[model samples]
Structures are given as structure tokens and as C-alpha cells.
Target: MASTDAPPLDANRYRQDFPILSSVLHGDQPLVYLDNAATTQRPRCVIEKIVEVYERQYANVHRGIHWLSDQSTDLFEEAREKTRRFINAPLREEVIFTTGATGAINLVARSWGDANLQAGDEILVTEMEHHSNLVPWHQLAERSGCRVKFIPITDEGRLDLEQLPALLTEKTKLVAFTAVSNVLGTINPVVEIVEQAHQAGALALVDAAQSAPHGRNDVQAWNADFVAFSGHKMLAPSGVGILYGRASLLDAMPPFLGGGSMIHRVTMDGFEPAELPAKFEAGTPPIVSAIGLGAAIDYLEDIGVDNIHHYAQMLTQQAHDVLEEVGGVRFFGPPPAEKAGIVSFTLEGIHAHDVAQILDQYGVAIRAGHHCAMPLHKRLGVAASNRASFYFYNTPEEIDALADGLRAAKRVFRR
Candidate 1:
């Protein structure tokens, strides 16, 4: 059954903006790229933005007074401003650039956690966190003699919200969780969670690696202490990530890395760090990637994030319905209404990798494995699963192709 209420979306025109979408796959099959959870295909604007930077205005930022350096610096800072407005941050300096989401999370766990957490403090994370969000805290706990605790998840892959209040206590130093689960596709209640954390006098950190690409990310509205996301996952290039920290909190925390541009003054004995953002962003930053990210933001804004989110939800619903009728598919997450645009499942008697390979033969790109959420996978009692994540450019016709490809995989496996 197709959704009658799905908002009208012009996917054909949007697909034209991504050049790789028209390319043929595996002999003659059309490419049905569904591996968006890993990374989204870059639009022509974003690609050209990177190329234009390298071809014309490439230079080191903030150090030299030359024209190329000044141009690069302005573009780089403009990217920060773009991101700040994109997420609705109160201060532009709060948006710090890093290598990726992993780097952003590690920055908080190392700098903020080290400065705030003590021997008896607790760091609360949820079971559905990606390793990038979980491991850094675990490392912090090991070093600080603090404890790392996880909020449980329901069988349907929803966060067990009822248990959260009891878990949060006066000893809790921070509540770190994902805005959207990478594997489960569950959109967690960020505002509610942050409120709870504040009541318990703890800071809240949101890993928006999945959520930032799908919908609005307002740090002010959520009252989040920190928010982290990667540009590549949102149609920008890799090697660039964002860490949105509260100005006061960022100012209090020590520098994570030490080098050029992040220092205000240096003596033979020690050094003074730069202001918010640059204090955390040591060394030369990802100049071209930042410019590309700005262009990606511009592209998304032109289409509107709300429209993309709604269309993607409709596509997710279509895929969920088709897969549910396939007879042997076992789903890992909540129903489509409860999820965003990701669907993770397994075909009976067929390994996830095998399922993925068969689908690839049909030119349908999908992901197979734990998706860097091994703890969540372990809790779900599945060793691995196949995932098909959708973006706004995806269509109902593509969902049909995915269903047909899955049926072909079933036939090949004799299941």
C-alpha cells in the first residue's frame, strides 16, 4: 500500500542535481543507492564548491595577510556561520570544526569530561549510541575513575524513556546520547532528555550525526550543552565535523589539541589558548571541505529540510510496508512512524553480507553489519543486519526496485 498523505516531492528534478544517480550499475541495472546511512551522494553544487576552492582560492587560513589566505579565511569562517545558522546556535564561535563526528565526541569526552567528571561521577549514555559516542566516554571513565552507564532500549528499538529519570541522579555529570540511532533509526527525545539532565544538574550532549541530515537541529530550542555531527553524512565531503558547544562550557574546558592558530599567546613556560572554537580546533582546519559544507547547506536550504524529511519518511514507510509483506524479513527497529528514514532487517536463513551481495548484483547499494553500533546489535540479539537508508531524492519506484531485489536475493538463497 502506498501512502495517500505523502507530501508531493519533485525527486526527478532533485535527482538531476546528483550526477552519480544517473550512472549505470553492474552491467545494465540502474544504480539504486540506498546506503545513505554511511554517506550521502554529493550534489553538483557541493562538488563544484570543493573544486572551485582548490582551483582558485586555495591557501592557508588566518596566518598570512595575502589575498588567497584572506579569501580562504573568509570562506572558512563563512562555513562556521552557515553551520551556526543551520543549527540555530546562539553564537557563531560555539561551532568548532574537527576531523569528523568521532573527533567531536572525543573532544568533549577528553576536554570537558576530564575537567568536570571526578571519581564518583556518572556519565549516562543510551544503549543505541554509535561507538563514536560510547567509546570516548568509556575511555574517560577509565581515566577519571568515573562510571559509564547506559539507558536501556525497548524490544522495538525505542529508547526506554521511563527508566531514564531513575537513572539520572545528582552524581551524574553528563547525559550523552544520540538524537537519532544510526542502526535503529529511532529519533530520541532530545529536548525531554536534556530537560531531565538539567533537572538532575547534568550537562547534555547530543550526537546528531544521523539527525542533523534529516531535520531541524536547534541547539537553543533543545538547550543542549553540546551537539556533534559530520558533514559527509549530510551530503558534504568527509574530513569535516562540527561540535556545537555552549559558549561558557567551551570557554571553561581546556584545549583538546595543541598547535598553531588555537593559541592566543605563548611563553617559554606555557601558552594561552584562543577563543571559543579555535581553542578546540588546533592546527590548520579543513578549508575546502568547510566551503563544500557551506554549499551543501545552501543546497539543502533551497530544497528545505522539512520537505526532505517528510518525503523521506514517506519513502521509509513504503519500504517498511514492502519488506513486511516479504514473508521472511525480520525487522530490528520500531515501525516506520517511530523511525526516521532507516530500515534495518534480516532475511531468514541468509547472512546479512550475503543479502547485501545479492542486492549489489541488482545494483542496489545497501549496508550490512553492525553499522558501528555493536552494543545495540548485541542487545537486539542479532550478529548483523542489512540496512537501507533513504534520503529525499529517493522515490517510491526505488522502493519497488529494492523489494524486487530482495525477492531475487531470496530466490538465490532458496529461502
Candidate 2:
């Protein structure tokens, strides 16, 4: 069992680091932000770092000898190194900056898939994957004449691990899945999945968008061929994500995009691509956003990932207990203790959209929709559901507020 008594953290002091959390929503109500699974609030350190880069070191990197350009280039490379360490990649050169998780997944589908896959080859994914993880493999399958397969998911929203051995075979080219379900909050056994993929002679890719913020991630331990996660979901700015691939795999895969820095020589016949990460990062790249991500990682490190994980789990459990006491609410995902920081459910006889609107009046902000995991929602026999995702800064008082809002919603809809 994970320890709940994390090193003493000043929640109030840490809350001060996020400016948005201090703001008044709808004129007077304190914001109870439960949409963290969508995007986390950026800390002041991250915001300040992004602002500083544009104000102080705004210049194109990698090709200029001027002071501003040199400084910008250095900062950009430093950010890459920071990301490398944050995910525990073997080499900094393996960290490729992407527009976001979607872009990173697409890069793998286009570059690696196109290079390695052929007709009769199969790319196996899970039924619980977000659309970002699913569509890329589907497109890759269509383009490369490869087939797409799905590992079965249980009624409880957890992957059926017992079914994995049967799903994987010699024809399997890659196995991609989410580390945590965006809607269900099921923490998939990534290490076990990786081992299964390797035993079947398939590459493993993990979509870490939902897991990276909550715990320490070591791709080395999982032995994943590629790992992709967005910065915005981890309290960093939008427009930046990290794609961590094995150095050999990244070196061998063809470039996903063609443009400025991704090329070594552009002849009339063909263009020679740059090496590793540069080959994948085609354009000028997200300079300021990368700096913000580095600062976000720094902020998370200061608080300690273990502390964040423990606090979030406590908050999630509190939410589960409160919601369970409510008469009309029906919880989804693994039982409260087995899941991560996300709680998703539906209210009896209430549309999810209606639930969201009613909750807004109390300033209890919870997300209500398909949450970009439509197939998972469909498999669970629901069109949509409400989701309340917690972070380290969230409190028990906020959970009470959410319960009050849900009660109010039930009363409003009961008529």
C-alpha cells in the first residue's frame, strides 16, 4: 500500500503558487476546480518563466551566432534535458518536443509505423484509450496496410490483463495504451503490458498524459519503446509535449515532418533529415512553452511527486465517500482505493450536461462529457458522464462543496 502520510506540505502555501486558484469565479464564489484531468492550473513559476523567455530571450535558435539566439538555443536545449530527466530517459537526445500528446502519437504512427509496418502486421491498442491514442494507430493501419486490434476492457473499466496473452502474437507490431484512463481513472499495469508486448516481439508505447502528473515515471522500468505526455496536463503551458523514445528507435525512424531544423541537406533529389529528436521536431518549436514546462517540472520536484500522489489519492477517496452518500449518484472506474485522483460518474435521471450547469451555480467546477474517450464511455453503456479530477492543491472542503452542488442538482432535476 502507498503511504498516505506524505512529508508535511503546506497546502495553503502551495496553493498560493497558482494565481488562478486565488481568483473569484462568477463574481464572488471561490473556484472549486475539478477539471484537472483536462488541464491543470499553471504555477506562478511556470507562468513567469514563459513570460521571461519572450521578454528577455526571444530569438530563433540553433542557426544564429548572435547573443540572443545563442541564449535561446541554450535554454531550449536545457529544457529538453530537464524533460529527459523528468521522465528518466536514457539520453537527452531521445526527448523530442511535440505540439502536444496528439502530435507525438501521430509522429509515431507516421514515422515508425510507416517505416516498420506492412500488410498483415497488427497494431494492438486498448478499448479504453483516448481518441488521441486510437486514431493515430487506425490511420497508420489504413496507410500501411496493417490491421488494428484491441485488447479487451472489463465492465469495471479496467483492462482485462488475463486476455492480453491471447491478444498478443507474432503478427503484433506495436501495442499502445494509456497509463491511466482519462475518463475511468484506471491505472493500467504498464510494466506488465510492456513485458507482454516484448515477449510477443512487439514495441510498446504508453500514453502518459493522465499519469505523469501524479507519480514518478521511469520509461526505463517499463521498458517502453515510446512514451508521450502533454505539458498542459501537468501544470505547464499548452502547445508543448514530450515524446520519449529509445535512442536507437528514434534514430532509425524517419522524420515525421519536413521543414527548417529537421533537415541536414535539401537537394533537388531528396532531403537528408537531421538526427534523432531534431528529425522529429521539424519547425522552430515551442520555445516559451518548453521553458514553462521546465519550470513546471521544477515546481513539481520541489513539492515531491510522492506528496502530490498521496494528497490526490486522499482527496479522491474523500470525494468517492461523499458522492456515494448521495442517493442518485453512480460511480464509475475501479473502487475508490484502487483508482487514481479522478472520480467519474452519472446522476440518475439527470443529463451530464444538466449536472454540469447546475454545479456551475455553486462554483463547483466539474467536467461533464465524453472526456475524449468515447469508446470507453460507449462500452460502459453511457453516452457521457461527469468527472471530477483532483490535484495536490484541492481540499476536503472543496469536496463538500461538490457534494452540496450535486444535491442541489438532484433537487433541481427531480422536479
Candidate 3:
């Protein structure tokens, strides 16, 4: 378990480290960034690391015999090591890099799902899953003739763990779920769910895109079979992510994408796939993006992820309190105590888009609409909701600005 005893974060001071945080928007308004669940702003260290890579050591990895290739390969593999430690996976070889979390999920769905699942086999996913987690399995089901089942969500936007038992059966081959809901912000019990999947004789896959960046993440502690998260969500550049599969499972599964790097030997008759990670990481990997993720991990480690988690929680609760004071704001998802630093709400008699536009006028950034979880939004009984997600760099004053923006939006809509 992650220690919650770290010193609280100092957002006021840390804000100086992010270049984009110093920007002004819409004339004179300061940019109040609250859309962290979508993506995070990069620190100067991470940005500088990317620039250094491009200027000094940019080259294709593991292909050429030249010195540059060796240098690039070393850096690339070092990034993989950083990812392995970041999630506390037992083996570095278990970590596979891909385009993003969506790509990782798709790789698992096609590579493992196609090989293992049969016509009567079942894939269990939660209703609050982002479309990336849902569509991959659905596609796998369509191809392999397997059945897809949903673990329902409660009225409070939490997984109905009581219904989980009835949902799992012998036919269930895999249980894929989100560690945290992108829309609802509900933090699901990853360890508990992984254990349940094991008991039911099914493999477990966790979509950690939302939670991995915020707190301590240990795949061994969770006893999970597969865990996936994106670099962009965690302050790295876009287009790079991680998939950590148990070595035993990965060794048994075939490669998802076949290309030059993923093959050990290509014959006129057939081709043999490369070992553990390379099997999934076909073609050239995202070299610079992976290094950026490693740098981002370094930045987070220095500050302490537990501290980030704690302060984000404080900001979340503050948002709830201030938004509640701003009447007509109906919050979705569990109360602040039960969730992370995400507050999704719908203002009475106002469309989410209009609210987002009004908030932008005040230079407050927030997300509006289903937020890539259409089913979760439908469960909340709203067409769309305004989401204000906080990170460790956000300040209390920004939450106040969010409330002020909502008040302004309400005044405009009421007229």
C-alpha cells in the first residue's frame, strides 16, 4: 500500500516549474488548468529531457550497428526499466511499450484474447470503463465469438461489487476493468477485484490510465495479470504507454503486431515472434516519448506520488464544497471522500458545453461531455457533465475561480 503520510504538496511553489502554467489566456486571464484527467502539463525537467534527446541522442533503437543506435537502445531500455519500477512490476521484461493505453489494451485483446477465448468464453468489463477498455474486448468478442458481460455500476457511480460474483463464472476467461473511472472518478478496489478474478478462474486486466499517475501503483501487490496506462495522462508526451503482463501469460500468448523488430527469424514459409516485450512492441517504439515518460516519472518520484494523491484529494473536496455553495450544480460520482480529484457535475437548466464556454471566458479550463465513457455518462442520467479534475500543481484559488465561473454561467443561462 502507498504511504499517505508524505508532506502536503506546495502547489504555489511547484507551479513555477511548469512553463505552460505561467501562460495568460483570453486576453488578461491567468490559465486555471483543471483538466488533468485528460492530460497533464509537463514540467521543465521533462520538457528539457525531450529536447536533449532530440538535440544530442536522437536515433532509431536496436536496428543499426552504429554507435547512435546503441546509445538510443540503451536510453530506450532504460526508459523501460523506469516504467517497470514506476509500477513495481517484478520483471523489466514484462513491460511492453505501445502507442498509448488504448493501443496496449487492443494488443491484449487481440493477442491474448484471440488465442485463449473460445465461442462460449466470457469477458467481463465494468460499465464505467472508458471506450478503450470496452471496444477492444467487444472487437475480440466479435472476432472469436465470445460473449461480453458488464459488471453493473451503482447509483452513486461505483461498481456494484455485490453483483460481481453473479457476473463471474467458469465461462469467464478475462475480467478487464478500470482502476479509476475517467468520468465518475470512482476509485475501484484493484486488489480485491484481482483476487476475485483469480478465485473465479479468470485473468484480470486493469486500466490504470487514471489512477497510476496519482498514487503508488504496485502490480505485484495488486496481484494483477495485466496493467495498462498512458504516458500523456501522467505528464509525458502523447503517443507512448505501457502494458505490464505477467511473464508467464505473455510467454504463452502470440505477438499482436508483427513487423521487423518483433520477429526473431522471418522465413519464406513462416516467421517466429520475438520474446516477452518485443512480442507486443512491434515496429519502432516511441523512443523520445518513452524517455519523456521516464523523466516525468523522475519528477513525480522526487515530489512523491503519495503527496500528490493527498493534495489532489484536498483540492477535490474543496471543489465539492465550493460547487455545492454555488447552487444548482448537481455533482455526479461518489462524494469527495470516496473518489479522487475529479468533480463531474451538471448545472440545472444549463448545457455542459455552455458551462464550459462560460468557464473558458473566465480562463478556467475544464472538460465537458461524456469524457470517453458514454455508458458511465448514461448511467449518471445526463447527456453530458462538466468535469473539473485537479492535479498536485492546482491551487485553492483555482477552485475558487471554478466556482466563480459556474456562478457566472448560471447567471447567463438564467437570463
Specify the highest-TM-score model's number: 1
Error (Å) of candidate 1 at residue 135 is 0.5
Q: Could you give candidate 3's per-residue lDDT for residues 1-415 as a string of tens digits?
A: 1224543978988999999998999899999999999999999999999999999888999899898888888889999999999999999989999898999899899989989988999999999999999999989989999999999998888899999999999999999999988888899999999999999999999999999878988999999999999999988999999999999999999888889788999999999988877878888899999999999998999999998888888888888888889999888888887777899999999999999999999999999989998988777788899999999899989999999999999889773
Q: Can you rank all candidates by TM-score, best first?
A: 1, 3, 2
Tens digit of lDDT per residue, candidate 1, span 1-415? 4567746579988999999999898779999999998999999999988988999998999888899999999999999999999999999999999988999999999899888889999999999999999999989989999999999999989999999989999899999999998888998889999999999999999999999999899999999999999999999999999999999999999999999989999999999999877888889999899889999999999889988888878888889889888869998888887777899999999999999999999889999999999999999999999999999888788888889988998899888
lDDT of 2 by residue, 1-415 (tens): 1334643366778889889998787888899999999999998888888888899997988888899999999998888988898899989888999999998999999989999999999999999899999999888888889999998888887899898999898999899999998888888899999999999999999999999998878999889999999999999899999899999988888888899999989999999998777888888999889978888998999899878887888887888888888878888889766667999999999999999999998888899999998888888899999999989888778899999999998888773
Better of 1 and 2 by lDDT: 1
Steric overlap count per candidate: 0, 0, 0
- Model 3 CA lDDT for position 323: 86
Runs in model 3 deviating more than 4 A are: 1-7
TM values, all candidates: 0.98, 0.97, 0.97
**For candidate 1, what is the lDDT?**
0.92
Off by over 4 Å in 2: 1-8
lDDT of each: 0.92, 0.89, 0.91
Candidate 2, position 209, lDDT: 95
